[model samples]
Target: MAELFQIAGAGDPRLRDYTDLRDVSLRKLLETERGLYIAEGEKVVRRAVEAGHRPRSLLLAPRWMESLADVLEATDAPCYVLDEKTIEQVTGFHVHRGALAAMERPEPLSPETVLASARRVLVAEDLVDHTNIGAVMRNVAALGFDAVLLSPRCADPLYRRSVKVAMGAVFSLPYARIEDWYAAPDLLREHGFTSYAMSLAADSVPLDAIEIAPGERVAVIVGSEGPGLTEHWQQAADHRVTIPMAAGIDSLNVAASTAIACWHFRPR
Candidate 1:
């Protein structure tokens, strides 16, 4: 069972991991340097732990302790008990879910490793919004896609906001960064997967019109929020695909478009 330490103030040094939760830049630096990520809410925390992530510690409001008792009993990490007000002071927001845990970040999986057995994959290029990244992961996982591959410049899926928005979907899905972003499509092709770049190009075909052969490996690519897929990716991809939309609606949000594509290309 974990040791319980009552924390009276937000300034307690031991609560450093829980401090300034809303500051993206500081949190990124601290978490990256410390090899940690924060999992918010009871369910996300439990999912993170169950997914084999080691908890550095847990910060919980008194009322949440009983709900997460099983988690506490299973780990040796200390628990810092705090009141809602102090919790708010430390985390910079109202944690209505009443639970947060700092977890040891695992080593990233290699693109090759993630692709070795994946048949249906989603590729994200330069998606800077943590929310979109998280939503994409959730959509991919919920739709039964095999994995997600991100470009080198994509947002960190393990960021606190991404983890929270994903509702722990990041834990269940297999994903990795493609360091050589330019050659991503080539890599997919080398792995025997046909790449479909989601774009608004004149030559793009309606997503429903594309046919997938039985037992075929496939990859669907979505780009950054502002600019869609790059010219290089569009040219390199096996096909340029687009969702048919109403007049004047050029595109949907990246997350929404990805969900639609994932559903269409899901294994038959």
Candidate 2:
């Protein structure tokens, strides 16, 4: 059974976890310090619960009760039932999804654990844009990719925008951060993975040109939006792959590039 409360004002202290959602810096600091992440919409809320994340509390309009009754029943967390207007005022945005939950952030898995069963992995280095990060995750999950590895400076995949843009893909995909940036190339080689750095270098191979034997392990590395892979990381790859462009267009955005790479490099 879940405890239900009524919230009439956005200023209510009980809604602290849902406040200032539009303030990125504030939300990042608050969510990190408090070990909580916001799960919005009924589907995302359910996915978060399904992924074994604990709920500290839930904020939703009355309409979502029936749809999420099972999830609420499973948690003893307080459920703050508010109207749509109150939700908007509290969250600093329109709560079009009609539901949101404050979920406890799960402990991050190590690089080794995430890679144990992964054959075709996407490695992100310093991809700080939350939308791009989520889009990549969505594509990776939809494609046949096995897992994802993030560099130390990557953005939070659990961030609200990331979660929303991913449409719950983040809950299903396995991922971890790599602490040792310089040693990653050797580590991938040791694990029998051919690390291909996605780049535009003149000597880079076309996306479909890479040769992979049956069941050979592979890892594709993508870099940040503003800057592509650093010189050191670029040189660290077993090979470099480039998605050729037409009409004098030099390159695509990070998210698009990742999607094409994921599609082209999908397990064969």
Candidate 3:
């Protein structure tokens, strides 16, 4: 059973975990230091719990309590009930979904661990946008990729914006950061995976033209939104691939291109 408390004001110390959410730098520091991440919306909260993340506390509007009753019953975490206005003041956002939970951030999986059982993977290099990271994760998962690997500089997939944008898909996908960004290609190759760099380099071939043998492990690499893949990655990857575009259109958004590539290279 959960303990319910009525929060009458926004300045309550107990609400510290939910404060200044819109301040990305502050929230990143606070969340990382506290080993917690905020899950917004009723569905996201439920998904977080379902994915084995323990809740440190829950902030909910009075009207949402009934709908999340079952979730509350399953945990003894403190539940702070407040009106939407105060909730907004505390969070620095409207929080229209009416439900938010501070969940314990799980231990990150090692790159080797993430690749151990994955036959199809998506590799993101220096993708700093949280929304793009979330969208890429969702695309990888939906298109049947087994896992994801992020370069050290990639944005945190568990960031609030990322989580909300992913609609909780982050919880279901297995991903890890590569400490040695330069050796990423070697790492995948060692695991019996052939890496295909998604690039617009002159020598790159259309993605649809690439052929995969049955049971061939594959990794589709995408880079940051602006520069695309780094020159090193473009050269180090086993193959440079491109999604052929119409005249004047050179490339697609990182997430959109990833979806197309993942679908094309998905396991047969």
Q: Give the per-residue lDDT digits (tens) of candidate 3, residues 1-268.
A: 8899998899999999999999999999999999999999999999999999999999999999999999999999999999999999999988998899999999999999999999999999999999999999999899899999999999999999999888899998999999999889899999999999999887899888999999899999998999999999999999999988898986799989999999999987
At residue 4, candidate 2 shows an lDDT of 98
Off by over 4 Å in 2: none
Writing each residue's lDDT as its tens digit, candidate 2 over 1-268 gives 7899998798999999999899999999999999999999999999999988899999989999999999999999999999998899999998899899999998988888888888999999999999999999999999889889998899999999999999988888999989998898887888889999999888999988877879889899998888799888799998999988896886799989999988877886
How high is the CA lDDT of each candidate model? 0.93, 0.92, 0.95
Q: What TM-score should be assigned to candidate 3?
A: 0.99
TM-score of each: 0.98, 0.97, 0.99
Among the numbered candidates, top lDDT falls to 3
Give the poorly placed runs of model 3, Cα more than 4 Å off: none
* Cα-lDDT of candidate 2: 0.92
State the lDDT of candidate 1 residue by residue for 1-268, as single tens digits: 9999999899999999989999999999999999999999999999999999999999999999999999999999999999988999999998888899999999999999999999899999999999999999999999999999999889999998899889899998999998988888889999999999999887799999999999999999998999888889989999999898899876899999999999999987
